[model samples]
Target: MWNLPYVFPMKRVMLMDIKVLIVEDDPMVAEINKKFTEAVKGFLVVGQARNGMEAMAQIPVKQPDLVILDIYMPQCDGMEVLQEIRKQDRPVDIIMITAADDTVTVSKALRQGVVAYITKPFKFERYKAVLEGYRHFKQTIMQKENLGQEEIDGLLPVRMTREERDMPKNIQAQTLQRISQYLLEQAQSFSAEEVAAGVGMSRVTSRRYLEYMAEQGLAERELYYIAVGRPIHRFRLVRQPEK
Candidate 1:
């Protein structure tokens, strides 16, 4: 059976740990951020700092690959720490997690090169998404010494079209695209079970997507019965008429 990596050619590369440091003025917030960072795979919480002063003092010692920072703090603000890090040419990525939602602060952070900015009172799911995104971003860049255009595109964020964004919540664009590509390669109609096997997804999921595609006029659905058992539903890519 062909797996996802096999279907789309990919190189095997060893993944290194993404060391992280949590820098928040509030002790409780810092701890929570630390826990969230550790929840994601391939990330290690190297240290935690309660304020910007302590953060700067420990940054060189910890040498973390990333920092989860807060904007408001005593001693020096997060912005100052960020600027100082950049001024010193420290090789570390920052993700801002704070209540400062003003345009100037946000613009400054972007200028300082923060990979992600999440405002306060954000949901845990959003927090996880940001962390996962950063993980993928780091993994993709580090895997290759030199990246091709495709590799570069993979690193950048994809802007989903209106139709794609409106797709059912359960259906992901990437998976749909994969199934569509696979179906286009087939010469005849195939059952959901066959598609499931080909795409490395559950039969139920494959069936759902196939049904959706059929409804969207992307595929043609048909029913066929063998000698005596129950009839089975099969699907194939919709034939496009020649011009």
Candidate 2:
């Protein structure tokens, strides 16, 4: 016990802290998101923007590794900010945290290459999960010189299989693709009535296809409320037809 060596072994550790920017208009929601971000390991909130304009301004200055963006802000919308970021060819990754559950918004965000899309009224666990998953994904890419097929598969979403791709009875693949293309081209969500008119189908037929698509995970159905009368049922395509 008395004859111990003076030298001691040491191990070196490296950490990569991710810089994050929160672009949300609501103060309360922004604060909550900030707390959630902090709760996750290896993530830091570099800045906060109340609207799209502020987001655009701070993005270049802060140069955050990631952005948690929200839709429906004054001066400009989140989609506009996303487009601007893409136009500038920024390296920043984005995760949408907003109430914009409409298919159009989600589809646009996906097309813009957002890393994650989280709807409003989400729990802490859900928030934590995405941040943690993003962290793992970022680190895996940064640390690896090359990834194997299995590793690459882990990073991407599971593709639909041929057996699982079959359409429901009375739902035709050609018609569904046409409807999906129409939804993709529109700037906003539409009702079944509008979809029928645009796609040359009856309202009942369009509604049936829309609902079927929604059930198959290719489309989203949302209820839009007006001041007068009952809620309007709207549909939007969430993803392109799987090949």
The best candidate in terms of TM-score: 1
The RMSD of every model to the true structure, in order and in angstroms, is 11.7, 20.5
TM-score of each: 0.63, 0.61
Where model 2 places Cα greater than 4 Å from the true spot, the runs are 1-13, 158-243
Candidate-wise lDDT, in order? 0.79, 0.82
Among residues 3 or more apart in sequence or in different chains, the pairs in candidate 1 whose N, CA or C atoms overlap within 3 Å are: none
Query: What does candidate 1's lDDT look like per residue over 1-243, in tens digits?
Result: 332111211234657889998998888888888887888878999999988999999999999999999989999989999999999999999999999999999999989999899999988789988887787677556755877543454344453343633568887667878888888788777789889998899999999999877654457677766555666777877522111
Model 2's TM-score against the true structure: 0.61
Candidate 1: where is the Cα deviation over 4 Å?
1-11, 154-243
